[model samples]
Each structure stands twice: as C-alpha cells, then as structure tokens.
Target: MGKLTDAIKHLIIINVIVFIAPQLLQLDFTNMLALHFPKNEHFGFWQYLTHMFMHGSFAHIAFNMYGLWAFGTPLEQMWGRNKFLFFYFSAGLGAGIIYTLVNYYQFNGIYELFINAGLTDSEVLSILKSGSTNDVRVVNAITQDQFNKITSLFNTPAVGASGAIYGVLVAFGLFFKDAKLALIFFPVPIAAKYFIPVMILGDLFFGMTKYSVGNVAHFAHIGGALIGFLIALYWKKNQFKTN
Candidate 1:
C-alpha cells in the first residue's frame, strides 16, 4: 500500500528476515534474542531489544508485522523516522520491564512458599540452576503447583513482537480516536476508542485468569498498550509546546 511508510517497511522487512533466518540458516536465535526470565541462564541485557524481532511461529510474526504496517505507518509519518523508532523501541522496552515486574511477583510468591516448605536458600538456588530438584526431601516438601511455577519461571522463553505491536495499536487508537475497527469475532465496525479498550480489557482478563489457550504472553500486550498510551498521551499534551 502507498501508505506503507519507509520506517514501517524496514521494520517489517527486518522482522520477517530475522524470523526466517533461524529456520533457514539453522541458527539458534531463541536463546540469544528471545526474552528469558531474569534468573534464567539464557537471560541477557540485549534480549529486551532483540526480543521484539523474534517470533515463535508463522502466525505470530505474520500478525505482528501486519499490525506494525497497519498502525505504525501513520505514526511514523506523523513523528518522523527518528522519533518513531524511539517510540517503538521505548514501548517494547517498557513492555519487557513491566512483564518482568509481574514475573518477579509471581516468582516471589513461589520463593516464599519454597522457604516455608523448608527448602534452604541454596537448595532453592540449586533448583533454579538445574530447573528441577532430584532431592527427594525437596520434592516431597511442596505441592505440584510449586514445582510447575518454578519450572515455568526458570525455563519458559518469551519470543514475539506482540508487546511492541500492542504499543503501536494503542498509539493508533489514541491518534485516530474515531477510526472504525472491525474484529474477527465481531465483523461490525466500532470506533477505535471503544475497540482498543475492549481489546485491552480482554487481554487483562486473560492474563489475570491465566486463560490462555497456549503459550501466550497476555501481560506483555497490556504492558505495551499501557506504555504506548502514556507516550501518546504525553505527546498529545506537549505537542503545542514542542512545536
């Protein structure tokens, strides 16, 4: 489409290229690029930025890149290249930060339970290191839930651009409040101001209830949307002053 701006084109190109490179080249980008939990051995500082370019499946990358092109083009046209790039990465980093904070709280809950179950600090650390406890005493001290949480916290790697795309979606809604949107479930179009909030609420419900059908990162979506909203709101308020 003629509306596809320069930055959006490049962003989509890079994402698709990186998404295919791993499979075609047999290179392992998951460990180096996907966002891993902070305590996980695969966690690295670069993951915050790199994770935005890594996706798990064809559907995952396709939908995210589509969202970027659909929503990001106008934002890039309005903000210019440098500012648009800054907003994109800033929203992504913010999404990662918030997602990690939520994970930390979940981990702390398990940490307390493990402590109460009589696992020593070192024993807990060992479990984190090895991703499991062979120690019978440690195994018997807690419910199956504890083990599952510990395993999930230490081993699950999040890979996708959904968080950052959610950011772009939020920005689109804010900038084009009256724009009509249609969803797959609801073919009838509605104004973006109404639709985006509903979408975000759906994600919140899913995240809080753990209502995912698979390995979905609902909170990351919420995080990106929130960050995008704040950034767009701030810019809206200060636009006159900046100009």
Candidate 2:
C-alpha cells in the first residue's frame, strides 16, 4: 500500500471499527457518538468529532470511505497530513454549525405552526421532544405518554463523514481544476473544476426545492465546500510568503 496520511488513515480505521462494532461486539455505540443538534438534551461537546466516525448504514460508510480514498490521498500528498487534517475537521465542524442553525430555525417555524393550531405548552413540548408532528403516531406503551412532551424537544441528529468528504471534494476541484474525473454509472468524463461546482449548485437548488429524496444535508455539503474553498484560496495567496 502507498504511504497514507496519518490523520486520514486514522479516521478511516476508526470509521471501520465503529461501523462493525455493533455487528461484532453487539454494541450500538452510534447513538452515543452521533452528533445531536444542540437542542437535544443528550448532546455533548465531543459529538462533533465522534459523529464524523459514525455512519447510519452500510451504504453510508461505503460511499464516504470511497470518497475519502478517492480524493483524500491526493489531497494529503499535496497539502501534507497536518493541513489536510485541519481542513477536514474544520469543514466537518462548519457543517455541524450550519446544520444546527438551519434546524433551529426549522424547529421554530414548526413550533409556531403548531401553536397557531392551538397546541398547549405541554403539547408543544411533546412535539419538539419527540421530533414528530401530531399526525405521526406514537408506538410503544412506555413512550406513549411522553410522546407529546418529547416530540417538541426532539431534533434529528446528523451522522456521517459527508461534510469531511465535501471538503476533500472542494480541495480536489481547486487543486486539480483541469483534471478530468469520470462519474460512476455514467460513462462521460467531466473536469473536476466544472463537476464540483455543478454538484454544489445542484445541492443548493434541490435543498431549497425540498424535493423528495432530498433528505440529504445538501447545505452541510455546501458549507464544507465553501469553507474548503476559502481555506484553499488563503493558502494559495500565502504560499510564496510562507515558503
């Protein structure tokens, strides 16, 4: 195997361990590591880093690891391990910040909608805690009563390496702007410079459109790309003076 960046390699190994932990050790640690939005009572400060290693499903881990291997090796070679690691974590953190803010606003909007419909304090609290509308049915005898109280406070947690991957995507586009990469499942080859921006734009459009199958955190992807692009620009400008 070619020499891999320490940080990237470490991250990959951790993700693999976590993904298989439940299957091998019979421990469901994803719930503990996944980053819950700030409104969640269970949220902890460490989740920002831990969540990057947690994946919701096999496809999630596979896709993320594939992207990391595809883009990160070249990035580490170009930027060195430390800088690459910094960029990766920073982008992931930025994604979490953006996702939190957006979720907060959405929660508020939904809260107001429920209040307008005459939901009481207890009722409102219930909806927020459970993360579901009145239309959604509550299951299980134990949670039935607390359903309304918890729903209001309930915020869906985001878990994945997508943010970091997006950072790598941005780096690939910026450094290899003219390099051509072919899309899987499609035979056509497209330049990285063109392909990456198009992907960002498409995410933004669909994110706003609220299209079905658009549950993916498109803004988080955009947030990571934006931060990555800015960091790359700064590095480019300072390269001569620093070196």
Candidate with the greatest lDDT versus the true structure: 1
Model number with the top TM-score = 1
lDDT of each: 0.84, 0.74
Each candidate's clash count: 0, 18
Tens-digit lDDT track of model 1 for 28-92: 87888899998877899899899999988898898898889878888887888778887888889
Residue 161 in candidate 1 has what lDDT?
A: 80
Tell me the TM-score of each prediction against the true structure.
Answer: 0.92, 0.83
Off by over 4 Å in 1: 128-136, 240-243
